[model samples]
Target: MPFRINSQLAQLIEQHYPAVKTAGFHLSPVAGLTGESWRVSMSSGEMLARFHSPDRQISGADRRREHSILRHIARHNLGPCVRLYSSPWLLVDWLDGAPLAEDAFAGAAQDVLTQSLVKLHHLPLTGYRLDLQQQFAHYWQHIDRRRLTPAWLRLHKKMMRCRPPAPLRLSLVHMDIHAGNVLETPHGLRLIDWEYAADGDIALELAAMVRSNGWNAVQQHALVQRYVDAGGYRDLVLLQQQVNRWLPWVDYLMLMWFEVRWQQTGELKYCEWAQPLRP
Candidate 1:
């Protein structure tokens, strides 16, 4: 379908590439909950432009931080190349690949993903720490308490008391790393969507993978083993403990995110997805 370009986006494109002529514009079939994404084809090449939603569900995401992280990851040939970034709007080189299927993370694909995560964790910190408590509070404050069920409330309380393992080693983590965010490219797996990226507990990253992918115990074990095999972490017990601590918190965050999204879009799908978690 034809994509609509707003005046601001057109102006930004003009400012960046004054001489280039636009050949075509198409909206990507896959849309992000927090933004509208489009593929803009020009005489030079194809680029992906994302217009950030003003009422994005995740309140902790900072566009500047994401831009910085994207630039860093791009330097390592990890994610999309940032072409232009102006608050709430970003344009990156369009990557050609298919998003990983739910069952694709195994064997070689698993190794590639593990290596990528290890590489991502080792990147120089950007001095931003993801505070789960603070993020939870932000989302909770925005949501109407009446919308929360007893089970969710109890889980929230449990999450509040959960503590990270001592001597937490912070790493550059892609806070959202589900199958959808990973692309299977000719070279290897490329992780996209750095909006929630931050320097945080590495275990939280693992927990996010498990939570987002709905991996069973066997699958989760295989993933953890791959991470260990990649030299990402030692002490399986400790890693498991850390992941355990983060799992509930991740669920709570997701619940609140879905709740907020449902409210914003009046979409019953979001509400239905959240119902299973409620009391």
Candidate 2:
């Protein structure tokens, strides 16, 4: 969890944050699936420097889009405060928190999770809507299909044929909302890693949360009810139906992310994760 920062990396950090020049500081690498980041500790204050991917098409992270969302979400107290957003890096106030565990996420902290999502959906819609079909197609282009297993290829074909249902309501949606992405801060639960967040169907966001976290029928139903009670949705039955339709697509996207990342980085972990997901 702790490592020394080399001179080159230290110099890079200084370029992004000049305040580190005067103050004693420490740099530790943080675990990230794709892009690299560091927890910057300084005598003055703490901050996080999130590096953006060079090939945006492959990583599917729109830093500009994320910056736009963050600028607004910070005012609403939904996310971290942005200090600077120069190309290839974003500097923000370091939030003191721990990532929620899967057990606590579903068992004890489900109410907070549900309420936070309701608050997210209430935010004004960004102009861009998250298009999963296009995203899938983009990822597929980069992956080596010739090396893909028959099962993965079959899932790809199936995803291509399946039509996603219409939106229950169009709003700002955090497309990724697993336990690891939710931070338990002193103030409250806050969502992090906004790389995939954008304007989309509320039902799609719910489906991603349920399927990724492996929520059971009862847990899923309870979430829908809580969302409705929080004034997040009107028709519970309709939203549930839409979420059901989006489940398979969520599986497809998750699998493709792993496959594409594997191809892009030659990282065996991505391949390992995909093996269990494949049919």
TM-score of 2: 0.88
Question: What shift in Å separates residue 225 of candidate 2 from its native position after superposition?
Answer: 1.8
TM-scores of all models?
0.88, 0.88
**Pairs clashing within candidate 1:** none
Clash-forming residue pairs, model 2: none
Please give, for residues 232-277, the per-residue lDDT of candidate 2 as tens digits.
Answer: 8989998888888888888888888888888887889998887777
Name model 1 segments beyond 4 Å from true.
1-5, 21-35, 57-59, 106-108, 154-158, 161-167
lDDT scores in order: 0.76, 0.80
Q: Write the per-residue lDDT of candidate 1 for residues 1-279, one digit (tens) a residue.
A: 123335556667777787654554433433642336767677778888876665653545666787888887777878999999987678888888998876676445778888999988888988877777778777777765678668778877877777744424689999888777889888777888888898888888888888877777787777777887888898787787788777777777777777777766778998888776565
Locate the minimum summed-lDDT window of 10 residues in model 1: 26-35
